[model samples]
Target: MTNEASRPAVDLYSDTVSRPSAAMRQAMAEAEVGNEQAMEDPTVNLLCERVAALLGTEAAMFLPSGTMCNEIAYRVWVDRGEEIILEESAHALHFEAGGPAALAGAMVRTLKGRCGIFDAAELETVIRAPRGHHGQRQKLV
Candidate 1:
């Protein structure tokens, strides 16, 4: 692996890290524009339609970013006081800014893993009850 100092310098902290290519700039300049907030934007509509079809789903929505997408999914999948089973290092749990608990009103059932992957037995064990009524119930999310 390349050392940090030897590797090509590029920002990895956010999507704003890199500048747009000339081709992308030209495309944007030539693309048709419409009102996104009013739901009339052609580009946004095409993205939603394309993703939904590719995913074999009947409906779709274009969220601003991955965090927004995860937050929206969390809100829909969770109920008040419910818990979701997730890998301990998963983006939904770590990088989502506490959206599961804050926006969805749900708790996390974080399971430890090695190299971001978990075994079936480990998942099953984590899903088991906490031996009392006070334990939070786990959901698939």
Candidate 2:
């Protein structure tokens, strides 16, 4: 067996494994940082505006990570006791560690799909119809 020290340093664990490149480091150094939550940061406001324009939305808020983005979206769009449909191996379900249930009071219904992708027909099969108090309302996918 190879020694641990001799193993390649490439980490395949997550998207955040890489350090910022020189250009990114330079940009960060030059950035005009401010309190973003106060809505007074000029650089953040500009980035939000640009992203909003690109996505054709009214506005956007730059979040620190995808997990925060998912949590926020779940809080906004999902009601308590509602269900979100997803593949069994979805990051929201597995990686986020039941954040939907803890944060949004939401539940998940998973589909059997290859590589976290499910077809529309498969989605249709699992969707809970809007009926009186039988199952949780299907909110987001």
lDDT by candidate, in order shown: 0.78, 0.87
What does candidate 2's lDDT look like per residue over 1-141, in tens digits?
869897559854466767888999999899998899999888999999999999999998899888888899999999999988889888888888789999889988998887677899888888766877977898899
User: Model 2 — TM-score against the truth?
Assistant: 0.81
- Top TM-score: which candidate number? 2
TM-score of each: 0.76, 0.81
Off by over 4 Å in 2: 1-15
